[model samples]
Target: MQQHRCGGGALAFCALTVAGVMAVTAGCSGGSGAGDASGRGERLRAEAAGAGGSAETLRRAADVLAAAGSAEMRTSMETSAGGTRVTIRGRGAYDFRRQLGRVTVVLPKDAAGEEGHRPITELLAPGALYMKNRGAGVPDEKWVRVDTTALEDGNLVTGGVTDPMAAAELLRSARDVTYVGETELAGVTVHHYRGTAHLGRAAGGASARSRGALAAAAKGFSADAVPFDAYLDEDGRLRKVRHRFSFASDGPAVEVVSTMLLYGFGVPVAVRLPAGGDIYTGLIQQGRTGEGGR
Candidate 1:
């Protein structure tokens, strides 16, 4: 539909398929910026005593989320290659207990400067990813279903939106965790922690729903250690988390930084799985991944 720049390797496949459609059309390149500092200095000092937490605390992030039941989520994924950078963003609600969520992913504008592609609606469930507006020849009314366990990056870096629940579950393997400091997110005070997690270990400890996918990711990525930064509220609920993942392709490895922000705890998230007939089972014209045809 537009002048698409489908690069080479895994990133290429992502571009030719989901990533390309979801890549940001325009935005200034820079950090997300720090939270407000209005009164955090005093608050940070007041909470300094309890700010340093052990890795065990970070490992329990998912459990804390499960207790919260659900939350509204915003996701941002950024990557750079050949000096050009692009970002993909998503927002929606999730039911942690049920391991289900819905996200609307926005892509950049096309060469004509108009909206490049329709926002992709993604359904995130236990082990499957359902997408509408996946545009590669399928009718607009049909949805594409992909088994998360079968994806190379376990759908973490695929679908252009990281699953919020899976992202929290991944912290179960937190190692070498250090308390960075206390910070405020959207006015809520949170403790910041940084660390590296081992995918194999996380897979072993992850819930049954996410185990297979994480295991697949462990084998697919070049390294098992994934670096991350996590922020938790006083009640232990995850306020935000950022994960850096490397996907090795035919060319240089593509680095993907996925950030998830959670808020509006206990939000109602109603999602219905698609019926069989609504799924598009035809070939998708995938370029290099052999993931095209059914």
Candidate 2:
């Protein structure tokens, strides 16, 4: 492993990108799209306002998203380690029904203030993650496929950005949740809720395609309890959510704060998986900090 590497295998693409430029971002929407039910929506809001409904409301976040069909999202992942902080941001859209999406992630500029790092395009799908513009030894035109289940963080932190749908699915494990009143986000009214989620428990109730990844995350993170804050719209759709995760590193543990903002409900999201030949199959080289070639 390289000194600047955050982890091993395909998972290292995240940190390697960071090492290259000292770098460097999903889910849910509401309306009468796919899963929207006025009756169910009323009950959902009523129940959420009732006693002990916070957790239950959160657990159904994925369902709310699925109902919305698709959404446009912006993500920010900030990792703090050894007094150094890096924030990676991304923007894209997700299709809840197909469990697919694409994000263009931009890394931070190096300390030397060189040109910005090339943005990485990531295709998120069931059980797999395909990344292009992944530096190191890979060619610009080739993509790298990573088995989400094989990643220690279950492609959660490993991919630099959490899968949008996966992030919503993780809410299925919400526990000790409390409604934190209403707030305005992006000019829309939303209800805020806070709680801790257990990845192992989440995997049990997650969508079949997400189970393996969440299960892997359960065993990968330094702890099982992930503190989070979620915001829901009038129809019980998830508008925003933030999760805090800690992972062990060579030195002190790195604290990652991931935030996802969803908007443009019922948006069209089309993501096509790359062909096998377009994927690079050779050993991937690790990048060093302060190095060029992002």
Candidate 3:
């Protein structure tokens, strides 16, 4: 039987793991340029107004992301617990057309061991989901029949597990886009944008509802709503995304801040599974664990 459990503390660990990988592979910088930098506060206020004006801007961003091809990004995560701070990094690549993607994360040596590691690599080709693991390396070559029906049911947001490119597309569709002035990020000037992300129809069908309900039952399955603050370059490509969330039920709030760096667009990279490594194909099947499910 496929037993899935909440990643719980794993969530924070996952975030940190991604952060660590990103820090090493892709240097984490703040901000981008200074072309339009006269009125900072005014621009931020205006941008916030535009985003608050309507949810359509959020939708458009998601659409643009969906239709786009492949993307490579680096991510960083920081979490605090018991007055201790933990960090991690990750690198990811996605192919929208094929609905296939891979994310590789490197964790801090002292943070946690292999048990805390999360590695996702899959190829949605032919008639099934082809998956392998670099961490475990168990199921060398395994195929789970493509459940398009299930994919359709989980909606776009939750379905991202099987199809991450779709998730990226949904995120891009967020509406009310506006420039929130300029800020210095890692020695570069960046334009910030604040907006709401609308869960498009593609992510709201019956299939999605059912799966979502189950996920919610497992760990207070709440719709992921994030007030995005994105830093972009002059070319309009994203440089950093900063946001926070409190998964706590009734305790001190825990904050999760993740920054993603975009590298190559429409470029494809071959995903290779680790040879002679034990594989854990059940990671994705697990639900949120520990307090996160409370």
Candidate 4:
């Protein structure tokens, strides 16, 4: 990791972005467009095709990732609500060939507000998603495992930038794409691209799926297109990304800004699956019941 470069700033950017938009300035528009959703999608696609530069670069970045066998990344995120803020950061080594890796999250004090500081970690092993919690609140259990055969539907970069593969899919399917400009990141020359994407649609893509952490950074998904920005290194890999969108559950509108960084392409990854002694599966079950405590 000589360059040792990527999305920490992006993650910090995400944290600051979330704080900046803690209060949504506009109303919630969470549907498949107001009218003629499909038709509007087509129009947007046409515009994206005509609007080259940044949009074309996104496709190239995806292509570069598609051929790489593996990579390592550092992911970080911050969320603030009701005057309280939580910061979550992680280090991951992904086996792109296997589409699996382990993400060890560095949870700061009050990272989950009421959840307290927990040294939580996730393992994206084959076919199953597992979590180990060593927090003050967890009761007698250190592991929560999900016997998952298929990935869930959600934003690509949700819950931090654990899965940049989903981000590749987003770049491929984005619309209204534009070139933001060029800048240097981590002392490396990089290009900046911006575009709008529909989270629901991105979820339905053939390659889009949830991974290890169900603790998504995003609160909810909207039918409205969310704004996203990408920073590509000279090698065409994603150095950083920023996604800004709105989610409304039942109360006021809230904005979610997600940023991710990717580097250390083709790095070796080693993951250890926990044993039966670690199994205490209440957390996943609670997540299914919508009372998740991660």
Candidate 5:
């Protein structure tokens, strides 16, 4: 079994917002024309035949991700509700082949220049999950056993870039790769492609059924086809992907989207936690700090 890369703080944050959007769109479109949901399969076939890049370009991008052994990344997250603003900064490393990942985050504070001073670490290793507080004396650790079989069930969603291989697998599984059009992303021109995967309605339906009584009562589970859209650079590297998921009871809706950035081909970064009196661990889950620990 090939290990996937774990996405650390920054990647995870981007994944939740950007990646979530991509997933939703991909599943919704299902390789059909932008608005016409019925002709997805045929539309994808036509698009693949007219793809702008050769097969070699796609292969090279796959190779880059496969060869990526490690990398260092930084991510910032901000959420707003009412009038208050909450922000966080995170840095971490990802081991692509080992399906392991680790990251340290600095909690937010109102004071300027206080962003990188406090640290919390999260690690996903084989057979166990670990979290530590690096700013205090003698770091603390938490662990969970690794279970490989769960990967097959599709229930296991790795936290960070440790699962890039899985992204590669999903790409490989995509069919009807077509050259849809071009768009500007972060000032760079990118070619867009759409693809479809059958993902048998039975499996999709079964998953919906497993959602239990709440889903059954509220939505009335139903099986449906999924779609995906991918954006690639001139070098054929996949920079973004969107997937679409269905909800049984509600009107046809879009679910999750995913975007990938600053992918360092197989190089890892070194990061150390900060040392200070106000630092703490599990800040995200623990909420606002009361001070004292150093």
Candidate 6:
């Protein structure tokens, strides 16, 4: 997430967790660059009595995604309401062995026009989050190094929202899952599955401390199942994922939806930890906020 800020509040926009990072990472540009519902797919369950959808198949698919180790991911999303729409695109690569990864999120070329195209880059290494300068009083040239467990702006904390373990957490927790069939995604034959996860409930069930920001996002989510779609390749690895849901009226009226693509399993990804020079010191407050480069 490039320029707005970092903290629990901005986790939805910047953190590299699942959806947090599966989509690693959105400037949460939050759809400023997204447009039209054309690319925004219709509800998966709304389509048909899925020919290939089954619980066992979905479970195996989840296993494959979790076991993929290191892979490349591409994510896109659109949020729409009141005749307005916001779209986002992001991509990331990770070397799970070293627990290292990087994600970049940007808007459509045309939508970014003269706004200077806000770009958010996040590096997930061992100790901290390497963030880009978001014009938040910090040096705008180098990345800001913030400890993963540190508190931001007195009360806001980064929490586990950016934790890399989130990837496996996503696969293992999905419920009411069903397989939707197979199709070519980015030219590769893939299998699709749909399900929902109550992130709020899950957050509370375990020690998944999201603090205020996460709690708030979870509150806006309803008990109703949020639609989800997953795509798996022949090797049973995850190739794509999509999540669709609507936030509460007090929140953004737009339906919140995100799509993710995965690939390059087992490849090595180089992640460099930022040193003291990379740390931002003055006024530390700033907020900011990809797609598949797979």
Q: Which prediction has the highest TM-score against the true structure? A: 2
How well is each residue in 61-171 modelled by candidate 3, as lDDT tens digits?
333443556567665555554344555555667654554556554445545433555453444331223344422324545422223323312212111222343333334
Overall lDDT per candidate, in order of appearance? 0.72, 0.76, 0.41, 0.50, 0.37, 0.47
Candidate 5 per-residue lDDT, tens place, 110-152, comes to 4122344446565544333344543324334432222322332
Over 4 Å off, model 6? 1-53, 56-63, 97-99, 108-113, 125-129, 145-168, 200-224, 249-252, 283-294
Indicate the TM-score of model 2.
Answer: 0.86
Report the CA-based lDDT of candidate 4 relative to the real structure: 0.50
Cα lDDT of model 4 by residue, 107-201, tens digit: 55433334444556777653455666633334555665554322222323233433556555566556777765557665555557778865544
lDDT of 5: 0.37
lDDT tens digits, residue span 1-294, model 2:
222344312234544223221221122333333234456556656777888788888998899899889988888887766566667778898999999999998777651244567888999999998988766688899998988897778888766788988899989999988888877777666778999999889989999989998899888788899999998877788888899887766664677778888888888898989998999987665444443323
Superposed Cα deviation of residue 246, candidate 4 (Å): 2.7
Clashes of each: 3, 2, 53, 2, 50, 26
Give the range where candidate 6 is weakest over 10 consecutive residues by summed lDDT. 26-35
> Alpha-carbon error at 225 in model 4, in Å?
1.6
Cα deviation at 73, candidate 6, in Å, is 2.1
RMSD of 2: 4.4
Ranked candidates, highest TM-score first: 2, 1, 4, 6, 3, 5
lDDT of 1 by residue, 1-294 (tens): 112123523432354223222232212221122335445434443544454445777788899899989988888787644344556788888999999999998755431134576788999998898988876687899998888787667777777777887899889999887778877777667788889989889889999989988888888777789999988776777888889887656654567788888888888999998999999888664332223321
> Best candidate, lDDT-wise?
2
Q: Candidate 3: where is the Cα deviation over 4 Å?
A: 1-58, 113-178, 182-190, 196-202, 205-224, 233-237, 249-254, 271-294
RMSD, every candidate, angstroms: 6.2, 4.4, 8.0, 12.5, 12.7, 10.5
Name model 5 segments beyond 4 Å from true. 1-61, 68-100, 103-139, 151-162, 197-226, 245-258, 264-266, 269-294
TM-score of each: 0.82, 0.86, 0.54, 0.65, 0.44, 0.61
Better of 2 and 4 by TM-score: 2
**Which 10-residue window of candidate 4 scores lowest in summed lDDT?**
1-10
- Over 168-261, each residue of candidate 6 has an lDDT whose tens digit, in order, gives 3344446787666657655555557777755554344322332332234354444335556766555655566666655444323435466655
